[model samples]
Every structure is written in structure tokens, then in C-alpha cells.
Target: MLNEGLSARSPKPKAKMNRLYPLLLLVAAAMFAYAPFMILAAPYESTMGLIQKIFYFHAPVAMTMFVSAFVCGIASAIFLFGGRLGADRVAMAAAELTSILGLIVLVTGPMWARKAWGVWWQWDARLTSTLVLWLIFQAYLLLRRFGGPGSDRLAAGVALFGMANVPFVYWSVNVWRTVHPTTTVVPSLQPGMRGPFWYCFLAFVLLYVSVLGVRTRLEKRRAELEALYLAVEE
Candidate 1:
């Protein structure tokens, strides 16, 4: 009897930990997210002009979008092979959030590019590949919404296939000629720029993690609500 009681209690601890994981992640993320802002007024002042300060926020947003897309691919693979409906929902959520972030990157990138390179838009490889990735995620979401029978499977396939562009986007500038700066941080080119760049980078990474966690939780809640609605209708 005691053993049975202990076994039951053991699971309670694990369940509690699982429930707290997201909250803990969010807290940790919040700490890092704001660290850069506490520093000097212009984090990128040493590396690029005042306008270049946007790189800190812009690069992280772009990187986070890549991460989210990669997660979608992983989730899609699990759903397809393991028949995990939860994974499918998670993929959909990540894809949606990634699309939103990608848009922010796209918009901010042009502004930064215009200020630094004197061009608002360029047909550079990196830019083009990034644009493709954005479109792919957008299409995946649309397919999920309007697709017919086997829609989930179709969307999963798209998610898996679209992930191919992620690497291309990351490597485009290196592999091909592009006006987009090669380094995410100006400090990478000049050691003096490292201080503020690192600060900003750390903060943005934390912010991304926090936002991703919140979005993931919202996605789970939305799924539960949908399931409940279907059951009620039945």
C-alpha cells in the first residue's frame, strides 16, 4: 500500500514540474531580454551608426524565425511518423508565430539596409531566400486552414519540405554575392563593437524564448478549446 501511494505521489511531482517548465523558461527569458536595454543608450553606437542599433533586434528576430521553422519541421516529422496530434498542433503554432516574426525581420531589415547600404531593397541571395521561407510558412498555414481530407498530412509535408530553405537563408550571404552585411553584429567585424552587441544579442535571445513559450502555451489552450467544442457538438 505504501509503495502504491509513493508511486502515485511520484507522478504528481513530475506533473508539477512539467507544468512549471514553461513558466520558468519565461522568467529566465525575461531576465535576458531586458539586459541590453539597461546598458548604454545606444548599444550599436561603436559598431555602426545610430541607425545600425536596429541590428540587435533585427538579427535575433530573423534567427528566431529560423528556429521556429526548424521546430515546425521536427514537429511535423513526429506527427507524420508517430501519429502525434499534439505535435501537429505545436508545429502549426510555431509556424504561425514564425511567420509573424519573419515579417518583422523583413520590415526592419529593409529599414536598416536602407540606412546602412543606401538601398531599401535588394535582390540579394540572403534576402531572396528569407523571403521564400516567409512565403513557405504562410502557405503552410493556409493549407492547414483550407485543405480537404488529409489536410494535416499535407500541411505536415509542406512544413517538412519548406525547412530546406532555412539552411539556404543562413548560408546565402556566405555562398553568394550579397549587399546584406555578412556579420549579424558589427562587433564581429571590429572587436570594439562586441560589448554592446553581445549585450543586445543576449537580451533579444531571452525575449524570443519568452515569447515562444507564451505562444506555445496559447496554442495548446486553443487546441484544448477546439477539442472541447467538437465533443460538445457531437
Candidate 2:
């Protein structure tokens, strides 16, 4: 009777989840389509012309990377101190998202910089600090994989340290004389450019939410399998 009851209850949740994936895919597809059209449709900059268009997607992706890192750091702190199973899964999901988004930022930034700055790369304050921030969370993932039994706690500590860098990346221009643009410049974007920038920001954020949901679900399943394995061993 208990086995029958468990089977009946389990399918209800699965049925509900089965309905979600198609909707997520549709939203992600729409966002992907919207991005390029908006980029091309936006008015050209008086100075940079075609090259300035990269800013629409590039800045928003960096912003998404920041959001992912912030989520990872917060979830890691909760898992370490609160010891909640849900928090641990969330931390793992957010870390994966951070690494993916950071890669996008790294790639797109260099592409944009090559045209704007006349070089492929520069070790300016903002750029260097942002790169370090990416490396720190990446190290967190590596430590979790190889650090063995108690590595989750160590990774959590690394995430907390990584969180500290977010501010430095944001204010690096004001803190030092650097070639990177400061936050102040954002407010002054011309209306034609601002419209596409904001639209791309909205699209990227929706994409982030859809991807994060799928990743968290996978992490939760992996945790459950590990728990089942340990139980069977015992």
C-alpha cells in the first residue's frame, strides 16, 4: 500500500515538470532571435559606427555574469553556515552559470575592444579584476572536483572571496585612471543606443533565468542519486 501511494504521488510532480520544459525552450528561442535584430536595428554611433553595436550585447552579458557570481556566492554562504541541502544544490547551479556567463563576457569584450581600442587586449584595472573574478569561481569548481571529501566547504570559502571582487570590477574606473568606461557613462547614452541596450539586457536576463532553472534541476537530481548510492552502500 505504501509503495502504491508513493508511486501515485511522484507522478504528479513529474507531470507538472514535464509541462515546463517546452515553455522554457520557447522563451529561450525567442530571446535568441530578438538579440541580433535589435543589435542591427539600433542606430549607429556617430563616432564608432558599426563597432559600437557590440556594446549592446557585451555589457549586458557582463552584467549577467555579475548576477550569476553574486548568486553563487550567496548560495555558497548559506550552504556552508546553514547546512541546507537545497542551498548546496543552488550553489552548484549558480557556479556553473557564472563560469558560462563569464566566458561569454571574456570573449565578447575582447572582440569589442579590438575594434574600439585598436588592440585585442589590455590589462586595465577593470579588465584585470574582472578576469580574476572569473578565475576565482572557476577555481571553486575545480576544488570541488579534486579537493576530495571536505572540498565543498573550501569551495564555499573561495566563493565568498570571489564575491568581494564584484565591487572592484564595478568601480575600477573611479578608483584609478583607466581606459575602461565608468558607470557614469551609462546614464549619458543617447536615446537611440539606450533603447537597444536596455532591450538586450532584458533578453539576456530572461535567458539567464531559463538556463539557471534547467541547471538547478540537474544538480538536484545528481544530489539525490549520490544520496541513494550512499544509502545502498550503508
- Best candidate, TM-score: 2
Q: What would the TM-scores of all predictions be?
A: 0.74, 0.83
> Which residue pairs clash in candidate 1?
none
Steric clash count of candidate 1: 0
Which segments of candidate 2 are over 4 A away from where they belong?
1-22, 168-174, 178-188
lDDT of 1 by residue, 195-229 (tens): 65566566555555556656665665665666667
TM-score of 2: 0.83
CA RMSD of all predictions: 5.9, 4.1
Candidate 1, residue 93: Cα displacement in angstroms equals 1.3
Q: After superposition, how far is residue 22 of candidate 1 from its true place, in Å?
A: 7.2
Error of 2 at 175 (Å): 2.8
